[model samples]
Target: MGPIIGMSPDKKAETPGKQEERVGLRGVSGGPGTLPEAEYGAASPLATSLDRGSGGSEDEELTNLNWLHENLLQNFTLGGAQPSASPLFDIEGDPGGPLNASLSSSSQRDSLKSKPPLSFSLLIYMAIEQSPSKSLPVKDIYGWILQHFPYFSSAPTGWKNSVRHNLSLNKCFRKVERSLGKVNGKGSLWCVDPEYRPNLIQALKKQHLPAAHAFCTPPASPPRASSPPRHLFLQGCSLQESDIDAATAMMLLNSAPGHHHANPCDPDSPLDLSRPDSVLVSSDPKQDHNYSSMALQRCSSRSSSSSLSSLDEGGPSPGHTRSRTRPRRAGSEGFHSDEDSDLGDDRARPQPSQHRSSPLSSSVKRPVGKRARREVTAKPELDEELKEAAGSLLHLAGIRTSMELNKHSAKSKKLNRK
Candidate 1:
């Protein structure tokens, strides 16, 4: 009924232990007198849950409720129907007993009849609306989807991969790779780069969500640095003198996200930043290294981080590097996420293909203890031997009878080895 202990509206919603009676909204049964704040609005946990989702089949059910909640809250313009009537939000109140099932069903049926059946485009638009302001982790997107859309009680195998593919190639969804820019000189976070939201809205509206154009607008921000970043790929992994022109390579490989103000991806079109935005990371390395690794890979660029850190570069940038950057990327590569569709919007993933699990998953049986897992330096010979083995496997399995199957099996083996 009131704010849950330690829970703030702005921060992540932390669920308390399951209580015998969980508080939520119940459709009315009694007459007007049985209400408290019926004239105003009654905010509840269910309503907040409805506000966060990033799409996928898992999000369909709960997310739809959230959409309904929004619909109830927002009134049609003054020109429509009654000018001074209250929005649907004021209808919520506490019912002494269970809601009238028949009444609730009828109201839902009427609402459904009032509008066309739900469309994929509308689902996507709503999902985008519910996405986090900091851009959303592709994995978190699914949980959020499930949180808001209860239909995915059991996510389809490889459903995440499918969503990822479609998101990449789907004309309506904007997907891109981004880097974790430093935040306050101490850490990094996924920052929503300028124009990304506008571009995605434009793209979706042009295709699946034509009606969305009316609501598409971006909040203005202060001026950002005009100069382009030097490194091209992942900042820490492979910085070298040979990699100096990473900027050029990055320029070649990447483009402005919202240059067209439309969501078209051509060879000439700029790299989509949606995926990168999704992959942005918080600076707290203590949280989970996998988030960092995944976010970094989304950017997949070469940067001068190592060079600057080691003084390999003659000098560091004249400006401080601690400033907050932008949301970096979006990754749904795990079973909970969608596939890596570098080409198109979300497409159907074949099955639950086991990706190569992180080393921390298990090292020599159970490497994850209270201490952090160490990435051991490999011997050159061992590295060469592994490469040779991989090459041989590829050569022998060159034209596999089932490419997808082979990839899954290979990935499974790799994960097992880790």
Candidate 2:
């Protein structure tokens, strides 16, 4: 071969250390001395560091250069490029590496996309079951699903139509009538049928979804019992003694003092005083006539002379006069002046037999002024007495008076004294 161009005959072969020096200088300066791209690839950071004479041994420099070369090949390679042979770049050895994390996240997304979402029926069941009333309207159900499942937030409007479709078609769900007075929109409440609840729970278990077991489990507490109906003040009264007209009985009840009006919404509320026709009268006409006659005969035969003497004595004392004005409770139906009044210091005084006569049998009519009537009716106790008397006469004929009434009467008398 001819002598190599640009080489003197006297020049000797360069050593490896001198060759490395020339290459690093060429890399730093971008001079003609730089090797062709095919020979050494791209400029290396390691060469720059070495040329800067960083404080490291030659072996350390060479090791760092090899590391740089491996990283460059691994990161910047084209399609089908072979992986670096260096153990530092081995992803299998680093389980917690960023590459592994990214791969895992992508796989999770794929799995989510491939797995079917919860069924509309199951979604509805969850919404209704979790509610305080175990029922929800269609709109509330939609809100609940969207709140619990983030996927539905961005989902199309078709899902809402599907939800309504599922509610209408599903046998497991049933529609309940909205309460009469409730103002919660026009939609009826939807609830899961008790007969199909177990089947739904079993189906939920079969789904094998995360946290789905919670739904399959029954509620920890039993359903709450509805509030008991309040007892009508006169529910215990059943007056069998007189031929009392239902209207008369109702009037007496309405005249009683201290009556508490029951809740209008309550199904078991007392007889509506506004509608007297609705009052239930149980007295037999024959029995009532006989009882009234017998009672009248007894009163006339036993007390004719005494009644005349009592009336001549000029009615009750002034202190006792206000006792009539005082509010009376339903329990005061059996109250007699001879019996102890709630006021311990007050003594019983004689009253006319006419005043004591049963209102149903009385021929005497005592005209009351509007103001006096207002004052009497305004007293809550009198209203209560009217209610109790009416309740007793209409529904509970022949029932004995309870000691509780006596005690209540006594309590009222004491309060009046105060």
Per-residue lDDT of candidate 2, residues 105-124 (tens digit)? 32222211111133567668
Cα-based TM-score, every candidate: 0.25, 0.25
lDDT of 1 by residue, 195-216 (tens): 2222232222222111111112
Model 2, CA-based lDDT: 0.32
After TM-score superposition, the amount by which residue 399's alpha carbon in candidate 1 deviates from its true location, in angstroms, is 66
lDDT of each: 0.25, 0.32
Question: Number of clashes in model 1?
Answer: 49
Q: Report lDDT (Cα) of residue 124, candidate 2.
A: 80
Mind sharing the TM-score for model 2? 0.25
